[model samples]
Target: MSERRRRIGDGLAVLAGARPDVLAAAPGARQRFVALGGVLLSTGALAAVSAAFAVGMALGVWWPLAVLVGLGWGAVVVNLDRMLLVGMAHDSSLKRNLVMAVPRVGLALVLGVVVATPLTLQVFSKEIDTEIVAMQAEAADAHRVALESDSRFAGLPDLRERIATQEAVVASGGVADPGLAVVRAGVTEKQAAYDRAVTLQRELDAKAQCELDGTCGTGDAGTGEAYLQARAAADAQTAVVTAARAELDTAVAAVAAAEGRSAALAGSSLDADRAELTRLTAELDRQQAAFDVENEGSGGILLRLEALDRLGGRNMTLAAAQFMLSLLFMCVEVLPVLMKLLLNFSPPTAYDRLVQLRDSGDVELEEMAQESRRTVAQAKEELLVLAERERVDRQKEAILARRRAALAEVAARTEAARAQPEAPAAEEPAEAPRQLWDTGPIRELARSAAVRTVRSVRRRPADRTPTTV
Candidate 1:
């Protein structure tokens, strides 16, 4: 079991290799960093794939691009997690750790949500499918209602009824028409009257002929008169028959007109309307069939998500379950970062102490280096000051040497003038007559002699020159 655990640790380390600084500062730091890093990276990989899958499902045609973006987001998340871990491990103070962790925590939370959503959806797949089916049914019902509400279909029942009424009128002949029925009755009555008038006229004419021939006892003058009367009545009947015939002709013509009007009205516009209705009904059927076909297939992941969203609001128990599940997955994704943060609370390990020691030593060495640089700079400044002073002293010495040379030349000239050896005694006594013994003149002479002696002593320290004129 120990060997197994060791192997697992080594494997994790491979996944999360250590940085050089981390390896150098702490003994066995490589494996620790690797193991922690591996957890982060592995979680990140899961997150990446899950995000790709979820986005691909939601975006449909843009799924490929969404998947790529999700992958990049996952990489960013993993990198942030790694940085957080590093900060947590390195920072010694709680306040510092919290300050450093703010951005990382925010990023981890965002990534955790991104990673958890897909897994949660998978967990509730059955419920989502059921919801999707129900949504499809509702959609189908709405489609049907929309089709039925169309003006063309809506008027179909009225159109059919109107067409049926028109057809019945045509089938029953023109008798159902009020105008045609009235015309037919008028014709029938006029024709019967004309026929009766003809019969009466024929009978009257026969009786008159019998009376004129006197072929019987009853055929007398009275009979003849009666026959005449009968003739007049027959004539009247003839006029009546003529009038009835004209009326009957007019009535027959009216009947023909009525029949023509009825026939013209029966089918002129109704057939066209019915034909249009047939076409529209066919079109509606086709549309409905197409709609049914479209709705038959299973909807995509976006539909499932929409269903889940609805479910979350409607069902509290389900919402709680989903939330808990998502939280669980989020924790899984951020486990590595959490581990590092938790470790910050624990007492420092040997490796932690070592790193701290190494850091302190580095700081001390840096301070020492800075001090050495300062000392060197100070020494250099002092050396420059001393060199400047020496140069100034040398310049003063050069000036003094030139002064001494000038004074020596003056002394040599004075000695030459004094060593001229008493050649002009008369001339000198005449010049010496001008108050040579007066106190002011004597003091001036002494001052000149003292100045000469001082110069002579400096030039040739062996001779003490006498004070002479």
Candidate 2:
């Protein structure tokens, strides 16, 4: 257990960007760094939770995938925090420290805000969900209204009414044409006239019979003038009834003909009308289905965020709570950087001094190494220059020796030519003697030139050599 605890401590110290060896030398700093590491760990865990919630709620990804992403996000946060902590060396200069801390704080601030949003949304999940439902309903209503108002579907209502009217007409064995209705009305009027005429004739006949029997009409025993008059009237009404019946029959036939024509027209167009109606109905249903789908899937991150904003706006307490919660999470994210910066502001600790000493020792050693290399390089350059100078001197010496040998050989040849000169007057000419005399000074001039060349070589400075340290 002790061993495990020790290992855990070491791991946390490393996570805090602290050297365990350095901390070992200064036990006082170990707890401080370990606590920082614990803060980092907690921050990472919070970040992971936030990421998981964001992925699940905002992106609507599968839970397992969200968890994987969360783990990756947590690792990234941990690494970024470690870098922030490690980058801040314990400097005594306040200006330098501030300069270094500003960017880091800014970065951490942005990260804190990003990490806090999802958690904040989760905190108000219930309210957000309720708001999302309301929003979806509102959107659906708006879409429905827009669809209704759209010109493409403007004929839907008319189509539906027409379909209903036509269906009723077909079911009731009625005609939809105005001419058919007029013909039927005429038939009804003619039938009423014929029935009236027939009724009159019956009443007159009854009266006549009554008169003959002396039952109720006039008390006359035999057929009198009144009875004869009633009989005549009854005969006239019979003719009227027959003519009225004939007109009624003609009107009825016209109605039947009109009905037949209407039926034929309705039959001819019914399929086409129904097809149009069905198409319009399907279009309306498709629009409704699309709206339903959109409304159902409307619970996204943006909507949730908007809901949270709305809630915050409506309730001061909620807004304050949201602000405070966000601040709390952000502070957690920024804690490591702030802690390191504050520690920098204070006097350097033992660990800082030890690290400084180690770094200074390294710098000194590196300087010594650089100096040694420069010295070695300078020495090598000087040796090469000296060797070049020696080669030049040797070459000058060889040239001098060769000049001396050539001078000596020329003198010997001159002496030999002079000793053999008695036979040369006829063969060689007087100009040869003058040329030999001119050659006498050549050796002296060559000797002087060789002396000057040797002097120039000796005087040239070895400029390629570097200065010694």
Q: In lDDT terms, which candidate is top? A: 2
The runs of at least 3 residues in candidate 2 whose Cα sits more than 4 Å from the true structure, single-residue gaps closed, are: 58-62, 90-102, 123-134, 137-141, 176-248, 283-298, 307-323, 356-365, 410-469
Regions of candidate 1 where Cα sits further than 4 Å from its true position: 1-25, 28-32, 59-74, 89-103, 143-266, 271-302, 311-320, 359-469
Q: Which pairs clash inside model 2?
A: none
TM-score of each: 0.50, 0.74
Highest TM-score scorer? 2
lDDT to native, each model: 0.71, 0.84
**176 in model 2: Cα distance from truth in Å?**
5.3
* Tens digits of lDDT, candidate 1, 133-218: 89999988898889888875787678777777667666765555554666788789878887787777676666566655655335
Positional deviation of residue 190's Cα in model 1 after best superposition, in angstroms? 18
